[model samples]
Target: MPLWWHLMKSVPSLQIVLHRIAWSAVIVGAFLFWRDGRGWLKRALSKPNTWWMLALSGVLIGFNWGLYIWAVNAGHVVESSLGYFINPLLNVLLGVVFLRERLGRVQWMSVAIATLGVAWLTFRFGQLPWIALALAASFALYGLIRKLAAVDSIDGLGVEGAYLFLPVVAMLVWSETHGQGGFFDGYGVAMSVMLVVSGALTALPLVGFAYAVRRVPLSIIGLLQYVAPTMQFLIGVFVFHEAFDRDRAVGFAFIWIALAIFAIDGALRARRANARAPLVPAASPR
Candidate 1:
């Protein structure tokens, strides 16, 4: 993702997002066609609720992608990392408010700690961490809608791409006509190729994630998600050499502690659940 951000440095962030959507739509749409043909799509489109939910999710994800790309290219990768770090906590809050889900005492404590961390960052920065908050909220909402939509992951993504396709095409055409387009604008062969490949870059990981979620335990998946933001944090601090002062460190430390608490709680729950399940006996005749 960082590499893609770097490669797309010269292109407008919106354009990068548009191309990603356009390319991803083609790839995911193809995969959906191959996997389930038109049947899955027909069923999905037959429901008005599905269309509404997907349209909302599509917009949220588009905002997320555009903002994230802009943040990375604008040298705010650390802030972007913070956004993802806050995402799970935001999900918890959203569930409470929108889904009427109750939080256990430990979960409440974790949320409180995370809230403090966000507050501290806001205080030190003299402004709300809008980038972080926006990213977290948008993605949490997207996830909620997808959950409610209850469609196959690949098929849902195809629907999202379909919603985004026309706007992107219009944007690209406008850019080209106005002589502001990056593609074929003398950026050379490698970049043009990268621009085209961005579609695969965007879609393949999502397909992999969708596949893994079905097989992996939710606890493990939840814990593993931190890996991406952690890498982004490292890249921002060490590779990109973004500014990191003591105050920000203290704030991030609070969030880390909260995450640790959340993760341990989830692990314990998973272990208990596993222990309570009935064991199957081996077949002697085999």
Candidate 2:
């Protein structure tokens, strides 16, 4: 996805974002209609509170997407990767503060270590890593909103798409009519296809994430989630050749250590809990 975004660097971030939202709505709407018919969507939208929550979450995810597209295209992929690396720890902190959940000593220590990493990055860079921080904060908050909203993942996603679909489509139409659109403004057919496919690329991971969240333990998912940022980090350093000198490496090392601590601690706890209780069936996707 980052690679695709990087390839579309010439396109405005807002333009790409609008295409993403518009096409995702079309794709998800089609899927929903196929899976459960129109009645399902009507039922999902009937809950006024859920609709509002989806609206709020839509804004958050939209902001995250826009910032991420801009960051990747602006050659800040490493910094953006740092954001995801920091996100799990931020999720833990958010849970503690907002969900009133308690963290173990290990969890607190990990959070502290991650904070130190961010602090060091800020100190060395001579400015706050605002890109990383913003991405992490926005995504973490989006997760929180999704967690609190009592709806299926697909339903919530569909709702979010619906909320932004028409306005975004309108914006795209206006942009194209005004000769400022990137979609067909001499970018070639390949670029146009890529732009449309971005929606499916965006929606598939989310749907898979929702499926996994239902069936897999949160601890396991937490561990698996690292694969993405790890790949992004590698792509940034090796593929894009972004600057990652020793100083930045040191900061990333601190966060990596913190993540190791966090992952290990969570794994041990999950192991103990499973040992103490009989296994329950995983939740159905529906």
Candidate 3:
């Protein structure tokens, strides 16, 4: 979806984000109403703590989206890919620390190798990859919040969208009145359509992800998640023709190797577990 930004050269990244938030609210809100009417929303609202957690998650995801859009447009796509590449490792570490989950020997080694990759990138780049780090950290936190929250994924997304909806709409209106709105500034019909569809593109994947996460094994999801960042990296290098000099290549190689080890170990563990016990269907998230 970030590649879609290439067609939106004239649009401000922030404006795109506003559109994403506002329209995602519309889509998810409509779905919730159609599915369960207002009961789910009312139940969510009655609990202040739930909404607060969702609101914070909303802020983190919004930040992640805005930064990612800007980075893709500003020629930092490769670095953006690196952020996602680091995210699973970060998630594992977060789990170990926050949830008291224990990491096996292989997992720890994988984390150590990934850390070395980031260190190498930092050393060779002569500075920290702040964009990458921020994206990873924000998204990791978002995932953590969502995992801890009691609400269903779509409903949680709806709540988050609701939290941002009015403010984002007001901002868009302000931008339009000030003649700074991309949707109304003669950017053409195609740009307007892209902006509108961005919301569906955002919500659908998340909904699908929520559905899949329940049905799929964690190790399989870990492997599948790499598909996205891998495509982004390929697009950056092959399509955008971004630089992939020797030093950057070396750094990425370390990360790739670490991911390989991590994935292999997870898959093996999962296979053994399945063999030892019959597979049980996971309960749907509520």
Candidate 4:
């Protein structure tokens, strides 16, 4: 269903995202409460320290989503893809600067290559890749907030979303209050049903990512992270009928190569980590 909606966005972008998220949130929220019962809600909402964390991440996620939606709608998906392509490198940079972690020479080169790719893209286009930059900045900040929040991924998403969801839903409603929104008018009833589905749609990928985050090696996670964006990039050009000029294609190719270097670095790090230790299972022994 998520893939369906994503593909459907060829006609319209933000509207589809809005509808999908609205639906996904409903189901995801219900599942959270059901699976964890009141425990989940209490954990997410009650901690004062967590509240600030949630709010910050919530706002950042909202910004990220909204911009991505807008970018797709405006036929800027190529740039948007560039943003996500840049994200991993930005993640590494954040680790160094914010977490005070050391970066090896290879990591520095990976960053430099990514930087060159962005500069090349910008120079070829004669403008900054705002869509990509905005996506990278907001998402990088979200990652920082997530790490510092120190809450379980599931609980944190719900909490931060709880903060932002209302205003977003309200605004969507308000935008159409004068009359049914162009997007919302037809099958108003059906769309509403779908909107309730948004919560689940919203939660599932995170759940997939969360599962992947824990179960998969970071090298694998880094590799898998590219899947969704790659799909988006293809859908943009092939499915949505967005243009992919020669220069833009070259830009993306370079980003992909740079990402390959980044992923290799991660794999090497993971390999060394495994070599240095018991390679103990994450699960504790009874």
Which candidate wins on TM-score? 1
Better of 1 and 4 by TM-score: 1
Per-residue accuracy of model 4 over 63-163 as CA lDDT, tens digit each: 78768866766677667877888998898899988899998888888788778877887999899888899999999999998897788887787776677
Q: How many backbone clashes does candidate 3 have?
A: 1
lDDT of 1 by residue, 1-286 (tens): 9766876798888778888889999999899889888886787677569998998999999999999999999999999999999999889998999889998999999999999999999998899989989999999999999988988888899999999899889988999889778687655678778877999999999999999999998898999999999999999999999998999999999999999999898899889999999999988995
RMSD for all candidates, in order, please.
1.4, 3.6, 3.9, 3.5
Weakest lDDT window of 10 consecutive positions for candidate 2: 40-49
- Count clashes in each candidate, considering only residues at least 3 apart in sequence or on different chains: 0, 0, 1, 16
Model 1 ranges with Cα > 4 A deviation: 281-286
lDDT score, candidate 1, position 137: 92
**Global lDDT scores for all candidate models:** 0.90, 0.90, 0.89, 0.74
What's model 3's lDDT at 17? 88
The regions of model 3 sitting more than 4 angstroms off are 45-48, 278-286
TM-score for all models, in order of appearance: 0.96, 0.94, 0.94, 0.85
